[model samples]
Target: MHTPYFSDRPAAARSAAYRTLWRWHFYAALFVMPFLTVLAVTGTLYCFQPQIDPLLYPGRLLVAPATTPRLSEDDLLARAEAAVPPGSRPAAAAVGSDPERSAEFVFRYPDGRQHSVYLNPYTGEMLGTLSVEQRFMQRVRMIHRKLLLGKPGELLMELAACWTLVMVGTGIALWWPRGALTWRGTLWPRLDWRGRAFWKSVHAVMGIWLAAGAVAFILTGLPWSGSWGEQFKSLATRANLGSPPGVWGGSTRQSTIPGRQLARPANHAQHGDAVAGGRGMDGMPPMVMDDLPLPSTPWAVGATTVPGSGPAGGSAAALPLDRILDIVRANGIPRGYDVAFPSTPSGVYTVSYFPPDPKREHVLHIDQYSGEVLEEIGYDDYGAVSRLVSYGTSLHMGRYFGLANQLVCALISLGLAGMAITGFVMWWKRRPQKALGAPARLPTPVTMRRWKIGLAALGMVFPLMGGTMLLVWALDSLALKRRAMR
Candidate 1:
């Protein structure tokens, strides 16, 4: 008979430990396979969003390059406003550096729906309009993030992510090379092997190859999870290693105006009338930097208070869009920055510049009346943890190194999906009729001291996973005890 893989260990101990590990791996795979496939497919699609969007909506997203000067920002805004329905007001404007790209202005409707109006920069011709939520990439992102189920979906994804880490860990342990490793059935699958054996080799090999990339993808995405991400952000901020202190420019001013109130129908007599002259309705606090509908919001300053414009009665007119553009340019906010228009008298003009490189990201809050830059936070100002997260976020989205980065991410995503499929196939072939066909439980309890310690450490790091693991362990132990008594 062929010797078992763990030849160095005594036969009895090896048999028991291997069986236990196999059972654990089986349970993890059973839960993770479907979710892994879904995440992989959605992730691959989102990785190519930059190239995909233009192809999907070329008429709206692309334009002919022009050597002549483009229309002024205010003119473009005016044209975009005219293109939309009467009640729709411009919320934000995104200017691209590329001459071939059309200018995009986002408008919020009375019912809180947002639409993107595309305008040809050179001639101010209205290209087309699209619902922001219904856009192809945005839909893909929502599915990937929360399965379109809102908070409940978010919790499920987070739990899936936590379980995915467990699956990866158990997978690596099971795939670890044993005594006398060789390329066959290890680095490369044995093509000559038949049926279940052949598929097992392929699954194991692919799992190992994709392990590191999968782990990175999972860890990076955890920061965006609703539960764990929120707790992590709070902890990091408390440690002063996340958003940094006083980044709000020493301005304690806050507006009582809420975004929903501002989003009400423009049919109201005055702009302030809808929001009750910026006093806020129903005790709703003023919208913060996070409330604006910018295409990209930095992780560091998302929660920072939005400063109010100073000297309310000094001048009835808020600073014009053109003047704000001048201020942005003077402050060296590069091309491709987004300008979010003020919604109330106390609201500031929010400018966000998010480039492919995380190091160049910047956010500026400008007073609508005085044209003063109330608060400015750039990548350099981010604390150590915040900076690290910035880089991770960019890399997670495959924006760090351009095409090469996206290609690498795509390959990893596809590899993960392939592994999930092959794992399912292997399990299906071996599964007995009318049963789950999980690996059989070992007859006796086995000492897995090192494994337990490692698991404990992992649980501490991820509290949600830790809690679930404890519950599973308790249930498993009870089942084992019952089996022994029988």
Candidate 2:
């Protein structure tokens, strides 16, 4: 049943707007179809990210049985560093999350060499080393995020996201019930005839589910990409990651750390011991304010050293990695707490913050007990909207399970693929009804008989798309008007 509003209107008037939006939806579909297919196929292949993350780092997620005294963080770091040699400083030091687990580390070595080393953190024992970069999950993520083209690839993906967002809105409008929501009509199709309604049911049901996820992911992903990068950045600033209007661009304090900053996290790469004194755990002095660094740059470098956040001072006091590790242990985080070691004394111990996902993994800063986050330029102060936005991002990217999350996202990519297919087929079937062939369609008329002019008006709101639509409308409309005038 169609909505009563449209039904009440005379056929001529009703069809004008109904058909106009429909045609615009059709055109939008045509523009996005091919890319949707690419996304589908690539996304389907990406579902196995979980299976691949471990192949890159072995004996870590699950440790092999060993019967030696557990190594101290210092010793394990020392061994990992020595293993790397001086020219190639280790970037991160990761131990197993479990106390009884394996001592493994993803060492982002200099020259861009990354190796997942299996060690006896106690004995500095070298069990094995694998490449984190070459993992299947990594490859899958590459395609999903950018389809392998890096910068250009990301741009294309963002444009696709914007188009996808538009499609979702248009699709919802198109699917709106003619009247009151119905059981058989709104949800499942009537079981009477098992024909077009069955597939329509499938598409509609799926579309409804897709609407929420699609909108969420598209909006969240928009900020991370280049097309809407500036706009997205603005959103982040509003969300408190940046300064107020008229304020200068965010400085070190105003910025959020871009990636993980584990101080002694088990999964960290080797030579990541900014907190582990020069000596191994046995002889190292208790870490003090001077011993640990302050907050610093959030980006991860092949060997790039992040600048410090300066000296620490305030209401919170008592700086100690051992205490943080103890608390993690006390909280059942276990003997080997995966802590984000302070890059700066101001920097607190951050736990499990892999990028693209700010939540999912637990993050705690061993503040001067200033009792606030030390890693983020702006920490713990996120408002409710900000927190919700952060959670949405994690769920969208499937980062809750690390590699497994990657795989789930890869699978979601397939759903997008299906949407693209169904969406395209629907579009291909409708292109012949009406074509906007002239420039007059760029800016809609105040009183328009057909919805096409309204669509033309909407197109003008987006600078680039509006310009393109105006050009197409002019050319196509001119030819039509000429033919009609003739």
Candidate 3:
């Protein structure tokens, strides 16, 4: 018959197993503590992604459709330029999958500069912009992610990731069964603080209590790998609960640019245009016919991905924005859809649907040349991998639970920060004199004796101690240059 096992007393002289585990746990604990500190802070701040985004962006991120008719992309671009300071340009627009969140215009300014007033996508109204730096949570996240140290800070954090795994391994080992008849020393926290046994037990027991969920959270934080994590993402996607990746949008769909061409270049640009000469070998006329107002030497407009939106079988006809937008709307496409006007004869007018839930993206490529619908695919249309990727994106950002989820992750980070502080205090009280890793100071005899076994018991469990061991070894062998010079 099977029974639940918990113990402190080593079984029948099998203290060896307990000893091995004890060593492993100590090694893992040392590095993991600091890593968890960073993870906790960053994770907590990231939890509020949804709330913070709306607050930071205000009416721009979410705004109901205009009472007036939606302005054309050209009109919106003109408005954005007129509204922002000179030399400013539109970076990208948000295509609302939700009508209530509809605002197509998004303008990004020069790097390092802040925008206080943003134009509304749906109505071309000037929506207010606020400073993200002023928010408390935002400031906290900045510290957690970068230690307020910028690039160097991020590098330090990346180096800390490996230590977290080590902690998990050693923690499990230390938490393993110690004895058959006794367990009070393992499961519950001991209040007998005067006893060394009590506090050690508290740290171990509390760690184990949170281990399962804590481990899961750690695994969840990493999107690229962890057991059958991909399968779970797949399941989420099959249910149509897909999220996009952080820092990258789900797809590379183009939004409507003004199609305003700058002046032709000084040299071969005009020659090339002269050769194409208002008509191509195919049917369409020159994209820039009159070559108005001495076009600025072919500066790049927002790049249109050519040959990307061409019809699956053949090219579609060239059409006006009015016709293309009308076809898109009539096809049951929402106002939030990305409308890409064709740049070349072969290029088609394309529309991509990327919802807050990326799974809702409905991609359609229409032949702009012919105004013919080329291809249409919805959330159900994606392959297994695509769907999995979307959901994983959302879960990584805690979009799965919305505000409640973000809040929980944020709190966990704060708890981790607290753990770091307490852990450092505990460490401080026990710091050895004559340097941390030096051999224990002998009494008058300078004896080789001094309780080596007990000291080994403590040091072997902490890998940070192992690192200290290496450092000592370096000095002992004169491998350290300072030692060598001496």
Candidate 4:
């Protein structure tokens, strides 16, 4: 009963399990480190966009305070249109409440690019023109989302995000104290430790502190991913947890033209007004609601159909910009909102009010000819899931609580970057010369039924990650077999 084999079985199993988990943790860190660092840096830069933009383009975005009443919306629009190149169409105008800020008018160039023409609201003088892609923060956002490589880049980022979850999970397990915890090596790093030991302690302590924030950042960001975001949106909408029934009201009319055809290229830039060119249909432009006019919309009503304008009764001409402004004020849609002009005779004027607070977000579709508010969706009408997402989006962008929110998000981002650097240093110091220096594979792999089941469950939740895992497993099995033969 007390044989040596029986006595050592539990210890051997524990050792095998630890090695296997350590190997997996190493692999996950290797894959996600570079991506996580890039995301962290870019995300930090974007979080401070409010402060950075003014310093970057003062002449274009800033203006001297004026005692005189600002020029009317129509006058500003006219000046903006006159300042643009020939063949440019005025798409939207953003009215800001700030007394010292310039007005912004978005225009669609003949070549399909969207540009913003800035004007001094007080004098109706052209401040400057900047393309959507030209803005520094927008560029950082694109890189953060897509790595500037388009679809492939987006997929890579998604894959990295998925693996980051795994990395964090395994990192926690590795950092977990086995024996009684001590302050020096558990909650805080032992600064007196030498070489790899010191670096490892730093990495472990930082990771433990960052664990909650890292998870939150990753989950909040998933809603914006190309693949997972779309699927989740479709699922939430179907469950009535997105837009909810009848939010579109009695209007069942769909745009004959697809939103994509009317929308700018997939890479459309969002600036002061954050106007996305049109609702897109494939590659063609269509007059749809989602991603039309405003580049960003509340997640819940993103796919809600835009109501079309009826035929004009007396005058076929659309309502004047001043009239729309009057309606906006009358409806109490805060002072700073973007007005998207109807692209076609049947198109409706779209007013989107996206403030820093999610509760005040609003979108109104007004009949271009009759000036009737065809459909209005506000934060109060959003489904539970949509409301949650709206709040999360605000937090992710560091806009929820102003400066405090920005500082918290910045710290998290920079913390992640620091963890990556520390991890790399730890690996480099101990890595064997002239080798990949990965953790050695177990000589006799232990049967880890529970671990396998947990990993399988995770893979199911993220299909892309699951598929990659299968491929890696197959390749590893082949390598093991070859090594055994040798």
Candidate 5:
């Protein structure tokens, strides 16, 4: 098999390899194309969520242009406390940076559900209440990340993404320059040709051109996958290759006294006397804010436990929210930043800033009692992996360079969709009506061995993809053997 089969029969060996690569590529696209289409469509929309949300939810987002000084924080809180549902309590107040934007107060129910109440800061009028998941952008994000199926959906998307990398690799190999360069038909499609031949050339040419962008999109997004992402993040942290040393003083772990768990004034639960505090409005458990289920966040500081309040009542002893706002602005944290008010008397106020330029990302935890900056993290403070993720995510969302970034991403998405459609058409035209249209397996031991080695290598890098490939291989072998027996 090794002697004359490959040496003297080099032409035959190359032909077999081409067929094998084509078969694998076809199988990969069968699984990957649907996901690629969904990701592209959803990602493009999410990239423009900033613009879309304002237009879609103007009543809940925008306010009458501010003509006077906004109401004081205490006054706004008092109004919000009065506005929440009888059984719900305010968890956090999101102070909007724009004068024309409404302030959002998140209310948590005893069952762990949360909703946002938007109020006009200047007029002290309630704008609207929206469940976080019901928001359009959040829905788009859920479909993009988990298909709304949580962990299982996340794993499926991750597998598709990993296989997409394989598809790109096999695609490049299939169309790679074999001999002399032919600019007319190879680099550029032969528009003069007619029918399937013309479409084939076009598909191959465009696929080759977009392969790099497709790979970038896949790799950048992998850091967000549930299993692989968590494992990779842990590995980076353990190796001291994560965010800059002592950035959060190793406070990335889940907070013991979560800020989101703090109860509102109407249903206040003293920091130390939870048992003594009354139960939720009716017979339900006390309401506490749950950690946000957001898909991605730029801030490297995960969760910094808010310290307990000072000697005085949790109210008067805590620093004013307006003062913390001033500190953030003074530190050059610009507008559009969000200030999450402390959930508990001891909980620190969190000022999070995600700007157009990724490098300017920052999250500051301010002590609620003394008003001291407890934990401050910025883009510059991120470790190698975190920095990569920040930049990748920013670029992926097309927030890096404004319109140009959006345009480039949009074109890539459109191009990807076009390729998927064109590839399917080409396959349909070539396939027999009664057959599955899969490429016939190479009968030679040498060729099969080569294919197995290639698959094994890819499997090592992306275990999920490898698992799927093995499943497909097993099914194919069984079918083929059964057919032979018949």
Candidate 6:
């Protein structure tokens, strides 16, 4: 007389439950493997940007350390403008604090293209011209974001990110150690084993070890996605998560210069009245520069209407760029900050400061006419969400703790690639000839109920993933019904 608990479900039923989970895991991996590989490679390379960038553009990015007084902002701007193609004008400048770094001047032409001219501030000598698109890291970034396909590619990546979470969840379920499996096989791969068993152990172990970082990579990157990202941003903004409306004072809704336009250094401003505004790489909204022919600042400056510099040449004849620079220096803006000159008579001069340590980020919009500080915002001014995202983004970019940050992130990326490879190898070897190699479907009624509940919960948490699963289920159901009729 066997006990009821001992015989419940039998051995075959337990095995079938595992197979069902394995099938879903395989499907999730099928959707996410390639993307994981791409992201791994790109992310690893991006992690080393601080080191790789100088190597890639040595002549343009690096300059010999000099002790002589640096050239004036006006003189350097003049030299940088002369280095660009005819008809191009300076839009913004990136002032490098280190004596060995070159000051970079950004120019925009009529065709909406942006380019950068590097100049040695000490000698007023032009370094080189580089298109933002032509930069190696920019290319890598584009590939990482959407395979360089723009919106459609972005959607694919976002979908992959979502499914990757599913893959990890299902993978964890399969990896749960039970029965005979102990630390030896669970925590570390059984290298002594051969063929499919060895691959399986390796894949499982890798997935377990790297799942946390992979999830972090996906979560941090989601803020940059197009659809869900934008919606989430809207919600976060509405809730005042981290972004306060007036922290960086300026009109948030004004149409500003498109990033693409700023990419071409040779393109002239086609629309004279177009406001130059948009969020920079740092994810902060920019202040717009009203009709003034001001140089381009970081995307953080966005679109801002520089208030009138007191009635042109009136009693408040706007102080020259020199005076504005002096005021900024006196007011505690460190040496690396940039001063964007005003183009129109009424346009105000804007000073921006962003250091590697994001906690020091600040920006000041000064009225060119009266030399008054219109608005100033610092890291402390950011709301809860903004502060969190700001520091997280910086860390994600490997800019926080220097080389150690880059190395850790790079290792995580490499680990992700290893898992992808191991997983693919396991599947390829186990798959039957000319078949998908999916585990046979033999889910019992109880098991099906469990799956339904689990899926419902997942759907509620991630609508995109749930919606895709539902669509697939519907398609499969329709196909099966049609086959029965036939």
Candidate 3's C-alpha runs over 4 A off are 1-29, 54-74, 85-87, 97-104, 108-117, 120-123, 128-159, 180-202, 224-390, 434-486
Model 1 stretches with alpha carbons more than 4 Å out = 1-9, 183-185, 247-286, 478-486
Who wins the lDDT comparison? 4
Query: Which has the higher TM-score value, candidate number 3 or candidate number 5?
Result: 5
What TM-score fits each model? Answer: 0.89, 0.63, 0.54, 0.90, 0.83, 0.82
lDDT of each: 0.78, 0.50, 0.46, 0.78, 0.70, 0.69
lDDT of 2 at 474: 71
- Evaluated at residue 210, the lDDT of candidate 3 is 60
Q: Write the per-residue lDDT of candidate 4 for residues 1-486, one digit (tens) a residue.
A: 232322345776666766777777888888899999999999999999989989999999999998999888888888887888899888888878888899998898878788988999989888898888767887999999999999999998999998888888778777777645454458899898999999999999999999999999988888778887777766665576766455333234222221122333222221222235343335443234565756567766666666667777765799889999888888988787888877766677888888889999988888877789887888877877888888889999999999999999999999999999998999899899898777767676588776688789979988888998798778767876897899
Worst 10 residues of 6 by lDDT: 260-269
What TM-score number comes out for model 3? Answer: 0.54
Candidate with the larger TM-score of 1 and 5:
1
Ranking, TM-score, top scorer first: 4, 1, 5, 6, 2, 3
**Clash totals in order:** 0, 38, 23, 17, 5, 40
Give the worst 10-residue stretch by lDDT in candidate 3.
Answer: 293-302
Tens digit of per-residue lDDT, candidate 5, span 113-228: 76788888888898888887678888999999988899998999999899987788788777765544354557798788887888888889999889889989887888778767
What are the RMSDs of all candidates, in order? 5.1, 9.9, 12.8, 5.2, 6.2, 6.4
Worst 10 residues of 4 by lDDT: 265-274
Error of 2 at 412 (Å): 6.1
Worst 10 residues of 2 by lDDT: 295-304
TM-score of 4: 0.90
